[model samples]
Target: MTRSLHDRHRAVLPDWLALYYREPIEITHGEGRHVWDASGKKYLDFFGGILTTMTAHALPEVTKAVAEQAGRIIHSSTLYLDRPMVELAERIAQLSGIPDARVFFTTSGTEANDTALLLATAHRRSSQILAMRNSYHGRSFSAVGITGNRSWSPTGLSPLQTLYVHGGVRTRGPYAHLSDARFIEACVADLEDLLGHTRDVAALIAEPIQGVGGFTSPPDGLYAAFREVLNRHGILWITDEVQTGWGRTGDHFWGWQAHADSGPPDILTFAKGIGNGMSIGGVVARADVMNCLDSNSISTFGGSPVTMAAGLANLGHLLEHDLQGNARRVGGLLIERLRAIGAQLPIVREVRGRGLMAGIELVRPGTDEADPQAAAAVLEAAREGGLLIGKGGGHDTSVLRVAPPLSLTVAEAEEGAAILERALRAV
Candidate 1:
């Protein structure tokens, strides 16, 4: 049955839509931190469906709220007053650090980011943009234009003139060997040097942790330093918190706080975990930037009643239970265990990340060359060992992404780590 489905999917879906594993399995349902494949196999979910299923599978609060809202209205466009949408927007605006913030909802991270670009370009009256190296925002035309990874970028054409910047990947770039202060200085100097060569720029956008770039990040406060230079040029700062928001990063709720010295970003975009799989995405910015457009704007399905209910409930559950605290506690244990395991494995190049969001980079034994083959082998092995992890990297998908539900428990973390250890050993 899985074989037939795979064949059917290949025939119909675009080839660019990547699927996991050599023999793909259809996940029929899930609960808590685990899920069941079509073959009735149970596997511990570590990647949380690319960090979208944040709180858990079938979180009762989100489920109840979604169901209740569906009974009333799933969507009514943006033409009428929607209580749930307004309520969620109010909550998010208050949480967002931007002064006098205004929120605009979209259907996905791509849309949120695309909207941000429109605002930045219109407000600054410039189409030039700065993006970080090895960053993956989304897959829309505008999002891909700023994406720095060639593997994910399908075209060189773009409406915005995007200049790739340094400091997104701490280890792969030219400043890898530098200390934290020196690395920040090098990146800032590079940014300043580049700005001297460019025309008017709209914004400097980045992911706090480069998600598809293998959970890679620069030293803390790297962005704060760059912010100083961008401010000099009157460039807007946009933080794409799609994967790093809602306390997944352990020490901070929003990933941008790692550079808090620069104050709040001019614009912030988020998706994934916010809805716990309900397709919630939006941008929050100071009123001036968010209101830059003069014409009418409305999202056909954005801020739908059902999705808003889900976001409100999911955000509520995440905070009421203090899942951020749980991520710090359990994720710390998990990272320690994985680092200890990686120490014994030659193919493991690095174990890096924060809180529940961790990455195990694989390389050829005794070499710096990325070992995508070994990563794939370990992914398959982990699946056989009853674990579901994810693989991603700029170097041909060579990083193992381990991000479970924020509610992950200590015992579960240990269990997943043990299974992952055996998987690596098998590879």
Candidate 2:
């Protein structure tokens, strides 16, 4: 009977579709940092649905808002603005401190990025875009174009005209022992050279904290220097906050604020946690730039009432519960513990990242080469031990991504670290 059901399920879902390799357990329900499989076996969710569930699964307030809004209205075309949409946009703009910022919402992070790229090129009338090496933006055509990973492209596909700049001078990882001054200088020089070489560059796009790129944070002064260069070249700086926004970083409400010493970017894109796993993403642009765009660019399903309600509720919960503070406190404990573990384990190369968005880079014993096999072993072992984690990096298998919900407790963080240590030992 089980075999027959599995066969039927596989038949219903198209076989040609890309398969995201999942564990054998079929997850049926989730709450606060835990998930249950079909057999009622509970597992600790360290990945938090790839960092999209910022608040946690089925949060009470978010669910209530979603239920109320669903009863009222679901969606209306952009032809008419609704109360929830208006209020949600206002809250986002206030939180971001981007005055009179105009928001254009989408159903997913990829679409949000695609729309932002379109707006950038449309406003500037430029075709060239600058992106950093090892960056992972999104999967849409234009987004894929600016993404630095060549492996993301399919066979026989032509590469986009986007110029690439080295993230840091040291070919080593972002945490390598290098002077901040030298690193920023090298990055600025590269940007200047790239801008000088390429004509009609529309924007320079980057993630505040590099998510898939080993969860790397650039040198201290890198953003300020980059902003100066973009200003000189008359190009806009677009910050992709899809993975880092919504107070996941702990120190600030938005990741960009962590680098507030640097001037704000011209366009900021957010998704993932904005609606706490509800399908909603937004692009907040300067008033002048948004006003310059034509009305025909609006999306039919952007900022639906249900999505806005969910987003608003999520934001309110974050502020009311002081979840960002919890992220900082618990994340600090997790980082310290992981670093201690890495100090003893030869395979654990580095433990890096801010707040809840963190990564552990696995390396071969006694070699600098990435041990993707070992990383996979650790991940599998963690799953077997009732913990779920995600993977990120250029190899897609080297960095063990750990992004628990902001509501995670210190005790839970300790338990997760202990599980990770055991998994590392088994590997």
Candidate 3:
């Protein structure tokens, strides 16, 4: 007996149309941190949809909220506000500790970042924007132009005046050797130099913890120093928290809060875990900054009732379940396990990041040079062994990013580590 036409059609879809270089698995369903392929194979999703599913997949509370909101009202354009949207905004402000912050919700991280950059330029009335090297803000024209990675600049947007600051260097071991004080000094000095040369710079943007930049956390006092410089020069500080927000970092609700002693940023952008993978992003601006924007800044699909409902439900679930504490505990365990693996694996270069947002840099046996082949091998081997992971870093692709859900169990972490160990050995 042969399969039906539907099966044949699914099998024969044009490969050229799909850009993702996918593995053999065709995931059909998911619950929590596990996904099942069409062939009924179950895989542990350690990547957590690139850290977008902090509450885990198909969360019951979030699902119920989304369904109920869909039945009532899916969307009402921003022209006429909705109750859920208002409530969600209030909740975000309350959690973020920015009492006067106003949110402009968008459908994706890139759009949120675009809105933020627009605000910065509008507020400062300046053209130049400064960003950290290796930063990954988003893919939109303005956002990509500001991002330090050149690969995203292929869209041919008009070039803008931008300056880049160097993030700390990679160390040869589990942890980098540079002290937080030294790292901060270097970063602040570079920014001062750039500000001295560049006139009327509008903003300085960065990730509290660099996500696509190999999950690298900047030095401890870097935020304080950067904020001081920006304040002194009257430049807006925009922290891109797309990946580090929503309790993923454990110590704080927002990544910037990891450095709360430092003054808060002038503008903050969030998206990835805002709706627990339900597709929502937002920019929270201080009162002065928000008031500077022109009325024309609007989004048709931003802050839809459905997305707001999901965001509210996800936030409530996190608070009720104390997931942040769990993230801290479980994430520490995972990091320790990764460091242990690094000790055993000669090819392992470094283990870095905070809380659930972590990475393992792979390299050749006796050199600091990146070994992309080994990294690819580890990814493939882990996937085949029922654990899904992702990759990041420079041209090397040496970093293995592990950003599992906060709901992840110790047992699951053990399983993931075992798979990773096996993969490393195989490589």
Q: Which candidate is the best by TM-score?
A: 1
Model 1 stretches astray by more than 4 angstroms: 1-3
Model 2 TM-score relative to the real fold: 0.94
Q: How accurate locally, in lDDT, is each candidate?
A: 0.94, 0.81, 0.82
Summarize candidate 2's per-residue lDDT along 53-133 as a digit string, tens digits.
888888999999999989988888677868888898888887776767888888888898887787888888877788878
Q: What is the C-alpha RMSD of each candidate to the true structure, in Å?
A: 1.1, 2.2, 3.1
Provide the lDDT at 346 for model 2. Answer: 95
**If scored against the real structure, what TM-score would every candidate get?**
0.99, 0.94, 0.93
* Model 3 regions lying over 4 Å from their true place: 1-24, 155-159, 168-178
Better of 2 and 3 by TM-score: 2
C-alpha lDDT of residue 331 in model 2: 88
Model 3 residue 141 lDDT?
A: 77
The best-first sequence of candidates by lDDT reads 1, 3, 2
RMSD in Å for model 3: 3.1
Q: How much is 202 displaced in model 3, in angstroms?
A: 0.9
Candidate 2, overall lDDT? 0.81
